[model samples]
Target: MTLDSETFRALVTEASLSPSVHNTQPTRWRLGPDGRVQVLEDESRRLPVGDPEGRDLNVSHGSAVEGFCLAAGRRGLVVDVGHDGVHVAELTVRLGGVSDPLAAFLTQRRTYRGKFEGGAVAHAAMARFEQSEDLIVAQDPDHVAELARLYDEAGLRWFRNVPYRAELVSWMRLSRRHPSWSLDGLNAEAMEMSGIEATGAGLVLRPGVFETLDRIGLAGALVAEAAVVRSASAVALFHRPANEAPFDTGRRFHRVWLSFTQAGLSAAPMAVLADDTKARESLQADFGIGGERRLITAFRLGVAPARDLAAKPRLGLDALIV
Candidate 1:
């Protein structure tokens, strides 16, 4: 059956809430003439430098697709998604859907980027994560510190790439004065950066200033996230079957994150660990990731201080539906 206009709007709005690289929100929805919904990619939002292979981009869309499906389930509707090898998917919706338990945490999930509270992660929580076949938790202080160093090395390596740095900064909403601060991309507040820190980031990420800082050996320390990573109660490595498509991987990615939220844990993705070949290989070898598994990503997991943060910035329905 065709989705009513109100239902369509509601579903698309919830779907848009799914996270994306740089918060680009590249997934677009179309109420096709045949009543099925068409999921399309907005090529203009592609992160050519940061995600040259489009793996992350595809993953972003996949998460949106899962979001849409979950939203439908919440309304007692089912979405049968049909996807070939292409980037697009057609969703067939109907009644008689069971709501997903993880859907309860969707609205509560945030990419917590700030420092986590100090303390050992609860044994129960750590045990739950450890029990998951797809996850490996590193709670050893030495191992976490080592991972932090490797993360910094990988981050600094990427920071030196001119185009990559430029592409990242372009999506950064460093000031509340920036026009798109509330619309899309990474805003300073969500990043947990103070005004001065935000301003400094804009300057530090500039090629010339970064070069000078690196020459003096200050850039590495400046860009380092070791403190943040080391503060985590534990780090998790997310892995999947080696040949699984990223779209499928992304579906599970969102679910796993929502599970973290349900367990009273906050997390932030450490993409550098999975994106850098050396870092990825190191993690796979050290973590005992079997040959049949692909290391998808990593996360720093911990309990965050209670605070009422601003709502996530997202484009309105008009911008998402075409």
Candidate 2:
């Protein structure tokens, strides 16, 4: 369990792969004087406008911790993990343990942003999730279209809300030329934008552009995003009532993500749906969800692309460790 500085650095790098809101990479770490690795939620990285409830931040932290645990297990270590303070988690890795079979997926998983080819999700891919009461999959084109409509409406709401769009825009790194492009947050390349279209898209992200689109009622929902939603083989929603077992919810949610990745299907978050309260409520009603259950996250799944995706830059472990 003894970790030199370099080993500790490697561990944290692998752990930080868990997705965050806008790729904020909101978690930080510190190699304690006592040898345990302390995982803390970076207060500065909190997205108050985008995630007012802080549930999304906490869920993302849980997912990051899970990734760290999987990596530890893969290295033959038994990990003791727990929360020490608000948004603070502690990890102690001891030698001797069987590796997690899902460990490989920790690196393989990332939100797929490309448009999906046609066809419904295979029946076999879903059979594995039958027992998960909280997961709902929508494969019918009509159902997906309804979800897309909801997604676009949600985007409109975001555009109109100054605080929301401003907060999102700040995190967007327009191109590789931007200094922060590889360090953190959303980089344009990950969206597959290229050439003149890439530069044009960046310009529209400027202030007033979104506002003008909102005022004109242009179909300003991201074209590629809409295409992805419409072409998705299936859309998945994970639901649970508020104030429930939040950590377990995240763990199960991350597991679902990895499971689908292993099965060769890619999952992308329909984050806009959860950010707008009206769209969130309407989605619940449209799907006839019970009164007690509320959707926590929405995603679309499709076949993985033939090539590997470029790695999104993260604030590496050294920088992550406070």
Candidate 3:
């Protein structure tokens, strides 16, 4: 490590908070030579069923890189970032460039999967979230309701698939007794799982619950749909041409997330829209997107309730740095 231990740990702490599929926390950090921070992908942390194509992983790495830059900017440092490949990103820190106004919120951002107190989101509040021209956000009530239904419809296919259910069951660390309980995977609190559901899950969750909850996916599937509809105040969707780079979109997404954080509003990423092909097409068509653009990401924007905490787990600083 070229940087001092304290500086390195601070960078890793902020960077690791970047959200990943199933809270997998797939990106790791190390202080490289010449004052650069190296971001490495932990391929072992990839979710086979949820992100087999690694699109989620690629976007996740992008978010982490943005996070590190934001963290540095908070301390009056400007960082130049580069994505070398799908797995490797390098950041060279300098002392120039204007700091982000919301840079202080790099650590306070959380993904709220629960219901939001619904109302009209101020247009001014949302306008700042459009970091780039690529973002397509819908804040009206009718449009948001329709998007919710589409999310529900798209998830049905994944619900019946044995492998997908098995993979979800594997990540359901519903009990503290589970070995990965403190390190990674979704916990009972994060999922906002009801008592009965959590009990049933804790009783039978294993590497693959193909025999247990695999049959119970119908209920789980409905809950997933309801959560999106119930919680969102607005929906932000993004698209890019097939030949263009999608990584910058992730960077823009994180800035919007941090802006919401500074405003006391919370949001949740809805990757299911991009994960299912039918869902993605429906989204593009419904939104009147053109120019051979593909839906790369979508999220529900709303004000989260008070006292809720982030439930996704992460490895220790030492564990994250190699």
Clashing residue pairs in candidate 3 are none
> Which residue pairs come into collision in candidate 1?
none
Give lDDT tens digits, candidate 3, residues 170-283.
877777788987788788777667767788755543435534454665445433565556457778886766665545655766776787788767777777888788888777
- State in Å the error of residue 293, model 1: 1.7
Q: State candidate 2's TM-score.
A: 0.91
lDDT of 2 by residue, 1-322 (tens): 5656776777778878877778888778888777788888788888898888787787778777788778878877777877766546788877886787788898888777777755445445756665668878887789988898888777866766778778887887776888888888888776566757667766665678766765676536543366668878888877877657656566667777888888778888887786678988888887777779878888888875577567777886666888
The 10 consecutive residues of candidate 3 with the worst lDDT sum are 203-212
Candidate ranking under lDDT, highest first, comes to: 1, 2, 3
Error of 3 at 140 (Å): 3.4
| Residue 83 alpha-carbon offset, candidate 1, angstroms | 2.0
Between candidates 1 and 3, the one scoring higher on lDDT is 1
Q: Indicate the residue-level lDDT of 233 in model 2.
A: 80
Q: Write down the worst ten-residue block by lDDT for model 2.
A: 217-226
The CA lDDT of each predicted structure is: 0.89, 0.76, 0.73
Give the top-scoring candidate (TM-score): 1
lDDT of 2: 0.76
TM per candidate comes to: 0.97, 0.91, 0.85
